[model samples]
Target: MKKLTTLFLGTLLFMNNLFAQDQGKRFYKLPIYGKYFETSQQFHRVDTLKYNTMPASVKKLYTNSAGLFVTFKSNSSELYAKWCVTDKKVGLNLTAIANKGLDVYIKNRAGRWQYAGSKGTVKTCEDGLILEHLDSTEKEFLVYLPLYDETTSLEIGVEEGASFVELPNPFKRNIVVYGSSIVHGASASRPGMAYPALLSRRTGFNFLNFGVSGNARMEKEVVHMLGDINPDVFILDCVPNSSPEQVSERTVYLVSYLREKHPNTPIIMIPSVIRELSYFHQNWNNRNHLQNANWKTEYNKLIAKGGKALYYLDTSSLLGEDHEATTDGTHPSDLGFMRMVEQIEPFVLDVMKKHNIH
Candidate 1:
């Protein structure tokens, strides 16, 4: 019976592929969104030309299209994507779909974005249907690129005669978020479910992700590049990647440098969420405790020195008391990401509102 089931599934997929090819579709280049600088490449977060001295670790991760996406409008019965990623990397803690897959969201008539479809690529490049049997009405789409892999090329496919147009980025103001693997989207079920991505969808604002996996250690060159963006709000969530000593030594410099560059921009600092393993591991628990203390101490010192628009975001309640929010006791799973968004959305919205960022 298992052999028969496998055969049936394989046949179905083959037919689907054949059908997609038989339809004779037209492909158009998908324009990327969430690009902060004009690098030599399209999906890069930084222009390596100017900041040639950035650390090698940061230079490598900056090319991953974590927060990037593409938008378009189509009036077709189906949608397809043909794309390729640079490295096609895989993560032990993260799903391949979230790391190097495509997530599609369509805007309803009410102006709310809804998850419509998703597809994970199996090779360096694959052409497959993302969604079929649509209502054939004109509507907007937002397709989030890979969160951990760099998208080297992408094209959206629609019916040969159908109208398809790439839309301009809807979100105007940028809220830059710089952090560790959590911010880079470690264990999200899909790319769009990451906390910063969720925040962007919920608020209809551009929450640019600068998540660098294990590399967000508050380095001087990284902080300087962040200062160059000069966003409306700056969110620092790098505590997880930095050791307690690193946090103590770098927090002041990180905050002070940004303050010196953009004094009035709201600099929101987020300490690491409680790791479930820390509840049982004394060293991990102690390390996290010390890191939070140091982060808050630096914030207080900056405030004492009249640092304006600096706020410490308390995320102790992020994962809830159940402690089932992580995939590896470190990175948040989809449920954990949802909880994070729910807890974080209100505070973030309030801060942006007060500052009249809308």
Candidate 2:
């Protein structure tokens, strides 16, 4: 009788612990939609509701109550979806849409966001796909389309009919990057190939890419946006377009503004990658040297002012010791991007580790 009672108690305890673990895990439940883009105009059409546009490989389609309208083409093999939510309360939604159905993946701050819970299948309703989470602890979310060969078009949105109860965001470290075209990922083969994408994969944290194609000046408005994000690390790599004086002046104010909100977050200043400048014919050497000098001067000043975590990365040795990894003359090729990743990886890892991200 005593032995039986002890066995029963052990079983009950095990069941109780299992239930507790289940309750602790986060669950996402939301509906999602997919669309295609045929032209720049069509792509802009989906920009309504502050939605961000996907790459051009997908066809053009939009939604307006009646449901989503998608066009089918024989040669098409890509699909994209766009949506925006200023409300940080709700987590991301992942979904799929198609008669033939396609295989896909979703990754979040944990890295490599891939679809969960279901496989490719025809949908009976317009918004038949769903993915959702309420936890704000997650920094970044990603949806990967793995069925790139035969599959096209995917629907992604926050899970529908799910309640969102605000919880504390557990992520402590944030990364903010300021740069020009390459940082914005102008012409990578795919979205995942972008350097930000690569770095996000390795570090598993949230990052804000303030990269503007041909427009990342030391502008006050841009700095305001960066300040709003309130990152843990600020990286300025805008040497592709600014003069040395502009870099020094604008960066000083930007760093100061960020320091107001997050006094401890590190600022990582980078110089331009090595490239040929047919316009100047001096190559990227002169511009790089001048920018480095300016950055060092400002960095030292900030340090002298008792800045605790100001940091710098010498990108001259990043792509290669002799400058061998560019595509056109200014932008990074795939190989160049990989090399850039190698250079910044150490700095990022150290910062994240200090904050206990991994």
Candidate 3:
């Protein structure tokens, strides 16, 4: 009877330990969407207001035969992903979908390439698609895949199309970035290779990208959404979306609103990258300059108002003196993106140190 009691006690303790371990494990349902496609009305529509202003290159890129790619980052040695894709009437098949894989390049660490062990074409199942990683760990990893066909919608998650398993919460000291098309990653060559993605990789932090192409006007709705997320740092990089007056008006209000809920949260304001020419040809050169000035004014105001947590990062020096970092005088090329990362690293590190989040 004594031996049986001892055995039962040992088993109970082991089960309790298992439950604790599982609870400490974290999972993230990262999102990946399919390529963009336009309907007939969108393709052939002629608007008198914007006629002849559209770039030929932009039109070409949006036409048939183009696709959008998505990337995922993970640290789990064993990974399982489930995704749901919508087949929007267009009858083309997915060309090929596989992990873009990762080149484990690290600072002061030897680089190695890790490939997805699974092979063959993956089809969207009724319950969604699943991909598994052979090994799981605490180190960071990147997953890249291309989306083809007329698919317009996709939902990705872990086992239940929602379960990510046994990984650290990189967002413990969250960094939320808000901006325009550049921040949304217009043309970064690969999905996960964008600057924000790279920054997440370097700093090992969770990133929430609130970049909407040509849509970041410091709108009230956007500010409200930003306030929903509790981030340690909030980065505003929306100079490309507003005129000087609009920027000034919204900056003060947005900052004030955020301060109301998160009195101690640090906010970082960034100006536009030095790029010539404009998408709308609306005198952006002067607008960008004034936006910077207004941002400084608001930043100083926050400082004076006993908000010592406010910070400003001048990104002017990021792309070099000649603005060589941009691809088409607007968006960043691969090289330009890397340089941007280099500039932001110091500021990020400072924030990390203050918060003691590695």
Candidate 4:
């Protein structure tokens, strides 16, 4: 009787395990290779030749592609993703899916970027997480990767037998943005939510995000490297990192160096976005005014010389006067980032149209 009881228990355990495996068999998954698809990642993990040449400071900053994206086409009705992020802590105020997370945007028949679904970061020790499925008929899709986290590996899966094609990296001559933490996607809800990323999704132009956190001071080395990539437009949004003296001293050289290299390409100079701290702190307010004053002085000098390629954006109203745009006194919240996008959208569109890049 004891032997019979043991045999019955073993049989029940086997049946339960078998049932679980059978249930998992319903979804067919295939790995999407990084080599086949186009990625906005400027540096590959394994590409040491380029990595070795960089200054240690640059290598650390350039390794993260905050606003980069992937473009692909497939006949599969279902789209899925499995990604591994190196960071254990995925997000802060933004959810995991928006920070170290990835999201999907589809170009509708109307040619507008519309939200699909996202794969939120997983807490398990496993290297991968199965993402939410995007239900659709045959369509092309854009996958926006993480903003703040380092991606170790990523693969997109689809229906077992549908056709798949890798779209070319849309940017030949990219709109290269060099700036402060905002360009690095600091506190953005997701990678795609960054202003440069938004411009890409909305306008169908390719952008290379060169945001380097607080280190985006007018480093000449940074400008020299930026000159190598032929840019249709150069967005210099680095004012937050500079003081009025620094802006006054370095702004001309930085603009002139790029202007000389890419004479035809448009360059947009943005004064610092209004910091929330300025409202309460007199020192901060005075600094903001000084920087803008220095910037406007520079702009007027260029305009006097008929410098049509150079442009200026007065960012005093970026988040609007409601005074509810930031998470910290300096860094913008997701809402703040979105509002920033709203103001720049038309300006960029008009610039591209004028240059025939659109």
Name the top TM-score candidate: 1
Q: Which tens-of-lDDT digit does each residue in 105-216 have in candidate 4?
A: 7768886777777667654222232333545566777777776656655666666676677776554447777878787777676667777777676666766677776677
Model 1 spans with C-alpha error above 4 angstroms: 1-23
lDDT for 358 (candidate 4): 56
Model 2 Cα lDDT, one tens digit per residue, 1-358:
9999999999999999856533423333222222222223321213323333322221111121101112111111222233221111210111122112222333344444433322333332222332333343322233322111122233443322322332222223456667776665533333344566567556655444445555566666556545655555788777667777787887778778878867777777777765544335665567766766787788788888887667777555556654556656566666777888888878777765676655
Q: What TM-score quantifies how close candidate 3 is to the native fold?
A: 0.59
- Cα lDDT for residue 242, model 4? 83
What does candidate 1's lDDT look like per residue over 2-99, in tens digits?
Answer: 99999999999999987767477988886688767767888888776677788887888888888889998999898989889865557888777788
For 314-348, candidate 3 gives per-residue lDDT tens digits of 65555666555665667776677687778887887
Best by lDDT: 1
Report the Cα RMSD per candidate: 6.7, 17.6, 15.3, 5.9
**Ranked by TM-score, top first:** 1, 4, 3, 2
User: Alpha carbon lDDT of residue 104, candidate 2?
Assistant: 35
Comparing 1 with 3 on TM-score, the higher-scoring candidate is 1
Show where candidate 4 strays beyond 4 Å: 1-56, 88-94, 122-136, 170-173, 305-308
Residue pairs in clash, model 1: none
**TM, every model:** 0.92, 0.55, 0.59, 0.80
Error of 4 at 67 (Å): 1.7
